[model samples]
Target: MITLHHCPQTRSMRTLWLLNELGVPFQLRTYPFDRTLRSPAFLNLSPAGRVPALEIDGARMFETGAITEYLCERFSPDGLGTRPGSPNRMQWLVWVHFSETLSQHTAALTQQHVALREDHMRSPIVMKLEAARLGKCYAALEARLATPDENREYLLSSGFSAADISVGQAVYMSRHFATLDDFPATADWYARITARDSFAASLPNDDGIYDRDFYAPWPLE
Candidate 1:
């Protein structure tokens, strides 16, 4: 089985959530959120020094966006991918990339404004500038969700897909530093995803940690 080396409350959790959703068998290697990223083992795995690095079949991969895309292409069940020649495939492809481009950067910028200690955060003027970018991203999502479609439940496809999972996880991260009130439709989309049977199985504790063995308490799907 593939092994995911990760630390809690970090981007690694998103990959964990994706694995759970797919009901794939894998091993989990947990690490603390400190200098472990600088260790020789981790450094050799990911020179960028980040958690959520993945090891599979003797090969290593880094970056949540890249990892998720590769997993979906290589491991997902049939019909779960943005297959070639499918008209909606391009749409899904764009949304998959947009999951990070449209949401994560803005969210992380806002984190600097609100999450850091008083002495650590930058000036209020900088915070306002970051907040503006975040607002624009939220506006795009709200428009999509509100644009009216009889079949508007999922972000793409007739049912759930990896694209939805990517977008959902990104939206879920926004809560750490911003309010969903500003992004009601996006908030509802993420809430609906977490309520899934698969997501409930992978839900982390208040400390934002998920024990792999915890899933073993009951047979995996």
Candidate 2:
């Protein structure tokens, strides 16, 4: 059986959401977003000591993007994934991986707002800049969704796929740092995709990495 090592609100949720959408029976090992991930046993699962370490077919896998590609290709190639030569393959690959772009900035903002225990340890400038970067990411999604002549209910023209889950999970983390109010198309798309039962299933049952729904930028601009 496939086993997924996950943290509630981190990138691991991307894999979890995909797993839910794939409809495959698998074991989920949930961990707190803390030092337990650095334990020797966990490190053996993921050399880098990160969430989303996967054990499948007796092999261990690290890296969210790699895991995502492997799972989609293995379990849902034509559904949650696009196989080679498929019409939406290129777009599928583009949007699927683009989630990392947004996630990177979210990581920075998270470090500034959540990871740092003392106020003096955080950088307001970094918070503002990273949050702004998330806005740019949101704008990119807005433009893609509002592409001329085509009405996109999801990222790919084909329909909902893992790409939505990938990016949507990133957006889920990002929303705490940045709001989607300005990007109407992206906002609408986020709302539509997040309404899915799969997305709902992937949510944290209790507290997650963040203690609150939103964290305002430092200095309160």
Expressed as tens digits, the lDDT of each residue in 97-167 for candidate 2 is 99999999999988988888888898988998999999999999999999989998999998999899999
Best by lDDT: 2
- Tell me the tens digit of each residue's lDDT in model 1 across 48-79: 88868999999999988788878888877344
> What would the TM-scores of all predictions be?
0.82, 0.97
Each prediction's RMSD over C-alphas, in Å, is 8.1, 1.2
Best by TM-score: 2
Q: How many residue pairs clash in each candidate?
A: 0, 0
Output the worst ten-in-a-row residue range by lDDT, candidate 1: 212-221
Return the TM-score for candidate 1, rounded to 2 decimals.
0.82
lDDT of each: 0.67, 0.92
Q: For model 2, state the Cα shift of residue 9 in Å.
A: 0.3
